[model samples]
Target: MTDGPTHYPPPGAPLPEEPEPPRAMTGGTRPPGPPAGGPPPPPTPWAPYAPQGGGGPAPQPGYLLGAAHKPGAFPLRPLTLGMIYDGAFRLIRFNPKATVGAAVLVTAVAMAIPIVITAVLTFTVGLAIDASGDVESEISTADAAGLVAAYGSLLLSIVLAQIGVIFVTGMVAHVARAAAVGRRMSLGEAWAATHGKRWRLLGLTLLINTVFLVLFVVYVVLWVLVVVVSPGPWPIVAWGLITVPAMICLSAWLWTRLYYLPVPPLMLEDVGVFGALGRSWTLTSRQFWRTFGIGLLTVIIGSIAGSMLSSPASFIGQIAAFALPEYAALLLVLTQAFALVVQNAFYAPFLAAVSSVQYLDLRMRKEAFDVELLREAGIVS
Candidate 1:
């Protein structure tokens, strides 16, 4: 966002010239310098970089190779909206082990153990309660143990599922980055990328959602207070007239314009949590609407695609439940879990790929990162 170069020189750039020796202010003694400009150090390799007024790097003609230069998921240029979506799918195809595969693996592991344990405990407990004749009798220790295990396992599954999604997103983000320049990482390699950063990423993901949720709860509570304390219909009118509109406006402004934009920076740029938040904020400046629109579109697309992929199982489950009420509960739970796994597997990586491409696309457009990436890919001579 500054008027200076937004990037450091590329990897092979020469070091900057050393500063002149300090001159004492006590006397007018000048420091000796380069022997009357005797051929300055080979003009540093960064010579090719041109800095635009707003931190953009110089153009590299070598990168104009068009499709020939695109070795990865999408072309190595500023992307159109459709290209972003296309890039997401291409990344999945190119690196399934790191994207959808990882997602499915994590979701299955996260859901499987807990669901089985919870189901068994709940079923056995239900049978015990049924045979206990008096419905009002105090719960036995065995019943309490079963209930505790059932509830705890369900709660544990949710936590694991959330953590797994976050970790998978982190892996997918890097996969998108590597794919931009024709790099491929194995499943273990992608998992290794998040070795020390998962907790930080999780904290960041929670911070954004938690802040928005607190704000929403506050708005609803205020309306409830107004309705309860006020002795007239004015509070009801105000709730409709003010509270809902205010909540929607505030949430939309914060969530739509900036949701999850920071995750890529945290993952790819290796910035701290707050640093990533600041980076995303600056990157989206003057480009908010484009990013927001792309994000909204991806959500719609992913939702439709996920539903299409997962809905059949759900419909079948409902039908089976109705047709065989005796086994309905177990059948429903198993079918719903399968449907969720199918949906989560598809959605997580798809959304992450879009977000990663959007981040890279923004960088390329604003700071000539495409030139850097082109050079990294050896496309730019």
Candidate 2:
């Protein structure tokens, strides 16, 4: 948390003048000088609103903390923790509550497919393993193998289920955003934006996760080696201490960017995954520290909340597994399925939405989003 200076211009000061035109060819072609004062090119339209520092907006307290921005540069505006909390509220404001609810519902339904698949597989495999007949006999090894296969199938089914959830969530977010802003959008309107580009998005996501996963595995392996080869328990203790926090921080950082990877260009420029990623990187690069800091904060907050819910369920689950293996197995399978469903239900829309909002903010910074917003609001007229 390095601090930076924060500065703002006096509100009443007229924005600085435009640079003077090149000295009119010094006596050569002075013929075309502006029609003897015909309204001076309408004041460049954007000039009057520019901040004295040349950025579009004045910084507030805690914005940049101790940093000064030059005129005509992008400034990091104050982003309070309250703004994020309010973003959830904004979802309802921008669209009817029903829209967000519908998105969540669709996500839940999409998630259920995998759970159902898992439950059916578990039940069938479990029953088959416990059966004894001339036609169908099961050895312990055979039963174990079948169970493993069933689990594999369940994992595969979940991947497909998640993809479906992704599409539905993106569509829902699109419609919600448009509707929130009083724009008309159909189900097709949402689908139309990303329909043909699904594979590309998937591939891009795979690439990113792959990179992170590989790095993670390498980190884990190195830590394990250190522990095994260590002379004492100090190495193990130190590794655990560092790895736990690092993993937590890593997960949070990833989640924040996950929501925005393709959002800016997808919503604004209408580009596909790769283009959107490139564009997002460009916009985010300028404000890396702010982006990373805010993202880490969100993750930490969410992790705390998630841990509260998951920890108790985990202990209860462990007790059930030991007390009643067969019934507990079924319950465990069911619980896993349900968890998947819930995750898909909420994650897709939430990610899509935050990305959309961040896209709006990015455009405001880079392209003067406020100007467009004012125009749309009829404030500029």
Instruction: Give the top-scoring candidate (lDDT).
Output: 1
TM-score of each: 0.75, 0.57
Give per-residue lDDT, candidate 2, residue 69: 24
Q: Report the C-alpha lDDT of model 2 over 1-381, residue by residue, as the tens digit.
A: 334424454223344453544332343434343777575533222223557767644544532222222111112232244543355345544443333454455545554554565456556655232222211224566556655655665577566666665565456445534532335455456668666666766776677778788878988898889978999998789888988898877765664454444643554466776676677677776766666665555445545554554456556655665565554545555555555544443444454555455555556667775455544533344
lDDT of 1 by residue, 83-198 (tens): 88888899999899999889888878876865686467545644122322321113477656755665566567657876898899899888999999889988999999888788
Model 2 poorest 10 in a row by lDDT? 66-75
lDDT of each: 0.76, 0.53
CA RMSD of each candidate after superposition: 16.1, 15.4
